[model samples]
Target: MHEAEEAESLLDAGLRALFAADLPVGLALLDRELRYVVLNPALAAFNGVSSEQARGRSVAEVLPEAFPTLEPRLRAVLDEGAELRNFQVQIEVPSRPGELSEWEASYLPVRGADGAVLGVLVQAVNVTAQRRADHAMRRSEAHLRQVLDSLFAFVGVLDADGVLVEANRAPLEAAGIRAEDVLGKPFWDTYWWSHDAELQAWLREAVQRARGGESVRRDLLVRMKDDSRMTIDFMLAPLRNEAGEVVQLVPSAIDVSDRVSSEARFRSVFETAPDGLALVDPQGRLSLVNRSLARLFGYTEAELLGRPVADLVGEGDRARHEGLMRSFLRAPEARAMAGKRHVVGRRGDGSPVQIEVALNPVPSAEDPLVLITVSDIGERLRAQAQIQAALHEKTVLLQEVHHRVKNNLQIIASLLSLQSRHADAGTQAALRDSQRRVMAMALTHQLLYELNDFSALELGPYLRRLTQLLHDTFARQGQSVELRIDAPEQGLRIDLQQAVPCALMVNELLTNCFKHAFPDGRGGRVHLRAACTPQRRVQLELQDNGVGLPPGVRPGQGGSLGFQLLPLLADQLEAEFTLFEGPGTRIAFEFPLPPVEESGHA
Candidate 1:
């Protein structure tokens, strides 16, 4: 009963009292034989037994489900005097089927007065709920990573100091950078935008503004690893805690490079159009005009911009033009006017010139706008007037020439007729042929004088009239001689160079058919055809039932002047001529048609 023994006894009683108290944690003491010598009420409850039933029994009998794991730890503490701290254990019992309870247990060797190992003291805590919560937190973190990485927009999480903590996949991929190059670094110092020091300073200001409880949004040009820049709609939003203080800054951005480039291109086209283009606002004022418009009106662009559109119209038409402009602004659509319908544009020098205009309305946000395209037609009108005057003068000259020539030829034919009356029979026949040839030339000049289109002759009408004249000239020989012409619905036209040769050939063919085909007062029909093929070739076919062309007298081999002239005319036209022998004579020729004249249009 010395002082030290008394202190020991006091300490032991206090330890026993503390262990017996009602607590959530279980406490137990085991003997050197790995048997439970003492256990509190909580330990007994955890083992599904009473405290009295747990004392002086082996650990196996008290807690059969926990004994296998506890025996080794107890043996170490008893034999080697070692201490086990916080060893995790899974507890199961029959009452809670298919459920495992987790516990953290600590085994410490208890010492006696002589420092000898006596038994092991065990302390355990039920950690099943805490372990489940930790596992759920890990799953939620992985799910959040999945959601953030799936977005195409650049998204990042930053601390209030503008230090990047987490970033999604897009920013890293766009800049061709690795996550290690951005994460945990200051946002402005990242490879996506670190090249520009001024931009970085501006970004820092935006971060400060976000930290001060305000959102910051801006258009930023961020450079990539390859030195390519991109326009981005960048935003930084503050995330506040329950106390309404900003704890984090969330930065997000979307690439707007294409939109920016498109706007630039559209602006360039508006300013550089070739025509005199102007944009008029709903108030009838010119909002914009290109360089062409300024030059056309003899005014600087600054002088025209913001000016009323009525200023460009003639003084007499200003009121009417302004009224129409206002009316169009109400509900505008596309409008066009032909250049033939002339309008006057008052230049800056106060002179008027012919102009053509088209107005088209563009869709707008608030006020309506019209696009005006102006074209000056002054030179075109002047050129047309000059052409008309020159053509009239040429017409008069041609008519005078034709009139004199026709009169002279008629006089020659008259002379021939008078001389034939006095000459011998053979000489009279020669004089008569000369008269007929001169008469044909006179007829061509008469047709040209009447039509007056010197460039081309209407072949259908001209041929029909010529044949009629020829038939009448030979009517004294026989009244039963017939003439027929086949042509297209629209009469064919040929240039004068082509028409002259064609007329001569036609006259010879018809004359021969009439003079020899039906002799002795006999009569027959003669056919003439003219056609233009789709491939731009002209074809003429003439035939007659004229005694089968007087056997052995082919087209080019005939001894008569008319027969000899046929091949010469065909060669002049670069044509292919064929004569077929039959009950009726068939003659056909084809030549390429001349191209239509396009110059000197009036």
Candidate 2:
């Protein structure tokens, strides 16, 4: 009787130890009707059932609400003697507090020592956060659909296999097909344009990208049922399950007919205005001419339609004309055509007069049919000359204002300096710091005055000057130290406001490095490196090989005003700051550099 009691005590101790093990959930069950023989308190509380409720009852009976898809999954594991393993399950209890969300789960089946089935063991992890993220994404999509409906362009939604499921009114009508007729049909089947192997390949890649959980938007031309081409902006995105199975697709189409027609009208007006229109083709043969060309050259409209536009352009400026055309081809879509260079012309009398030419290429049946619209600009040139002179006067006035503002800043700096010489020690120190800050920004404007781009500065040169300013401000106070800056080859252009934050940050960090990083009168080297990654994250690293930070300085924790302001500035720039503690302190700052659109002012 004593031996049996000892054996039972050992068994109970082992069971308790198993339940208390530091696993995700510690539980076990028997195969007989899937009854739970033991469960940890964690599992009990997770399912809101007690150990007593769990021990005798089958898993299905105790938590049917939690295991809606339990039976078949369990049988598969037992029948095959294989682990059921890491399958996800989601169930919505009718009385649960919120929306139903998919939760990930794990399961294992237990067998006897004889290798026979015992029961299935289960572990569940709530992925409600991930599920909520998915739902939030869905809500965002719904919001986008509402916005798309408000646009004038047609929109469409397509499935994985290329069946059109939904479309806005514009595209459906433009395709000249009733919604019912196109329903359930292959996307290409009713396409008014003939499909080629190249287009077939393009569509295949697009579908593959969408199925791979990526979204792509591109311009597509659809030949309408009436044989007219309609350009559309097409977007494709993925719809998938957790298992990565592509179930459906949502496509949006925006008809760009109005934009296309507007371009066409602009081309017509520019080419047919009461001026001679001509173009030099790729082979340098002047091939294009409008009806105005016939009237200007005293030739019949039919005769001059395909004539070498050279007939109206005389020989003296022919070489210049060709050169101008070559240069224009380099940037065909420049805001305006090339300046009206001299081109020779002949009339019914075969006379010559100076003519100004403005050539713009309009996309047409012939690739880039350049329209060399010639106007006798002798009068207009004089008028433009007068206007340009007036514009120059206004620019000079603006420059004078900048000059006056720059002088005012100089006056403020001089006033601060004079006051510092006659003030208390504390006031003197404050005035000197203010003067240094003013000089740093004053140098930026001085640099801008000599350059065209004032809104942004190159990282390499900017950093060089900034550190130089710090060195000049501090090094002159009988302080000896070395500062080094490493930056990428191509400059990272930073906006003016961003420049201030970046400079102030570097200034504070360096001041700390200078103040405490070295103590034994040894030369200290401070390293600064800035790089922009392909992910658009800007990484800025500052490190010193000195004796690391002083023990009393805890980086963001109970430090001075500079440390507190460092985090606040980081918050302003939306940057992440990290400090590594070691023999030498290393600090890294990285974040998405604000995009061009997010910049408030220059």
**What are the lDDT figures for the candidates, one per model?**
0.82, 0.69
lDDT of 2 by residue, 357-436 (tens): 77776655346556676777667767989999997887666556556665677788789999999999978866875665
Error of 2 at 391 (Å): 7.5
The worst-scoring run of ten residues by lDDT in candidate 2 lies at 92-101
What is the per-residue lDDT of model 1 for residues 1-602, given as tens digits with 9 covering 90 to 100? 69989999999999899788997788998888777788887767666678787788888876677678667778889999999999888867432446777888899999997999998898976677546667999999989888889888999999999999999998898899889988999998888777799999998899999999899988899997588889999999999999998999999999988978977996788778776889999889999898888988999999999999888889777776777778778877544331222568899999896887777777643577888888788888899999999988888999989888988999999999999999999888778767877777787788788978766667778778778878887897555877788876354667667777787788778878877787887778889998988876778888987676877887678977888888898887778888887888888888866765531221
Candidate 1: give the clashing pairs. Answer: none
TM-scores for the candidates:
0.58, 0.43
Which one wins on lDDT?
A: 1
Off by over 4 Å in 1: 1-176, 179-220, 226-228, 231-275, 295-300, 315-342, 348-350, 358-370, 375-384, 398-421, 424-429, 442-449, 489-491, 596-602
Error of 1 at 302 (Å): 3.1
